[model samples]
Target: MNLNLAVISGDGIGPEVVREARKVLDRIAEKYGHEIHYTDLLMGGASIDVHGVPLTDETIEIAKSSDAVLMGSIGGNAATSPWYKLPADRRPEAGLLKLRKSLGLFANLRPAILYKELQDACPLRKDISDKGFDLMIMRELTGGLYFGARETKEVDGVMTAIDTLTYNENEIRRIARRAFDIAGKRRKKVCSVDKANVLDSSRLWRKVVEEVAKEYPDVELTHMLVDNCAMQLVKDPAQFDVILTENMFGDILSDEASMVTGSIGMLASASLNDSKFGLYEPSGGSAPDIAGQNIANPIATILSAAMMLRYSFDLDKEADAIEQAVSQVLAEGYRTGDIMSEGCKKVGTTEMGDLIAERV
Candidate 1:
């Protein structure tokens, strides 16, 4: 199979980690007798430097023509970087938001798995960490509060701010279906999180999700208010399989889930439309502080490539091989600085990628 992937190596440590992912991918292509073609496209601050914009029409078109996208982190220090000095809509992250919306990548999948090898690195108590959780947060990305209308203006001589939270049944149904479908492949449990008790938008979200639930009877469905869901994540993460929620709540909860799994450097995320096409990326940001030191972890970005193989290309066996290689490497006590424990052998960014690729 020929895999045409659009590579957005973003800014900061994005390029470094993405380079390792490509190394691992090249090994996959070689061993599996597949041809992988990567079209290097620019976005974020990198694009800003070259094109004076975070994203461009040419870049977006090229990305759309590819089978899938594999991206690293974007943006830099809000305190120092000129990228941050730009207007809100012109910042690096705004480019990412624009790209996602333009591509109609509505469903985001952030899997937080507590690897047994990294149990010591987990911040949770030994008891909670011992139980080990491997949950996927299936977030509705394109709709809801993030894209809704809002403005700040004077009302009765007082400054009032209003941010709308809206969701149509179609949007809720589609993402809900994606969640249940993924849950069917994993543990067959869907914990739909929302603020239905208070927010009318969440009320509609619950209704649409329930309406969609009838289509997948094999998948057990349950609803939890967003507040309880937040508490439950820290209290009993093991209870969740696939967490389904709308935009704003998902944005918050996914980040919370990332922390429970030892390090954010180990988390991989995917954003997909209704079709099979998806954008796979690491959940961590552009760590400009550690960007060029080669100390950053590339496992998340590598795992994200595995997600691309599985979700976009439907190359399940290849995906399994990459995942198993990651697990094996972790089990062997090779660690990056972010995930380092006392006894494990520490490796730099390139060496960590080399180890995983060699294992693969």
Candidate 2:
């Protein structure tokens, strides 16, 4: 099999981590008797420097031509980076928003897995951490509050802002179906989180999701209020298998879930369209502070490549090879600074990639 990937080595440590991910992918291709082609395109600050825009028409066209996109982090420190000085639409993160919108990527999947080897790194209480958790947050990316209408104006001689929160049945149902489908592959439990108690939008979301639940009888479905769900994440994360929610709620919860695992550098995310095409990326941001130091952890990006293999290319065996290699490396006590513990052998970004690739 041949895989064509659009590479967006965005900014800061983006290029570093992306380089490592490519190294792992190359090894996977070699071991599996498959061919992989990478089209290097710029986005974020890199694109802003060269093309005078965070994303260009040419880059979008190249991305559209590829089977999938593998991206590193985008943007830089908002407090200092020149990229952030630009207009809102021209900033580095705007490129990502544009790319997702252009690609019709609606479903965002963020897996928060507490690796047994990294149990010491977990921030949760010892008892809670010992139980461990493997949960996937299925976020409805393209719809709901984030994309809804909003404006600030004078109301009754007072300055007020109104942000519309809306969701159609189709949008809610589609994401709900995706959640149940993925739950069927996992532990067959879907915890749909929403604010149905107060928000009409969430009420519609609940109705649509409940209707969709009837189609997947084998998948156990439950509903939790967003606030309670937030509390439940830290209180009993092990209880969740698949967390299904709307755009805003998923965005907040996924970040919260990532933190509970203890290291943002270890989390991987995917954004998919209605089709199989998807964009895979690390959940962490571009760490401009460590851009050229080679101390950055590439595990998230490499794992993201694994996700690309599984979700986009449908090469389950190949994907497993990469994931197992990562686990084996971690088990062997290889650690990057972000995930380093007292007794483990610390390695640079490149060396960690080398270790995982060699294992693969």
Best-performing candidate as measured by lDDT: 2
Cα deviation of 8 in candidate 2 (Å)? Answer: 0.3
lDDT of 1 at 49: 94
For residues 122-166, write the lDDT of model 1, one tens digit per residue: 889999888999999999998888889999999999999998888
How much lDDT does candidate 2 score? 0.94
**All models: lDDT?**
0.93, 0.94
lDDT of 2 at 285: 87
Task: Tell me each candidate's TM-score.
Answer: 0.98, 0.98
Q: Which stretches of candidate 2 lie over 4 Å from their true place?
A: none
- lDDT digits (tens) for residues 159-261 of candidate 2: 9998888889988888898899889988999999999999999999999999999999999999999999999999999999999999999999999999999
With a 3 Å backbone cut-off (N, CA, C), the pairs that clash in candidate 1 are none
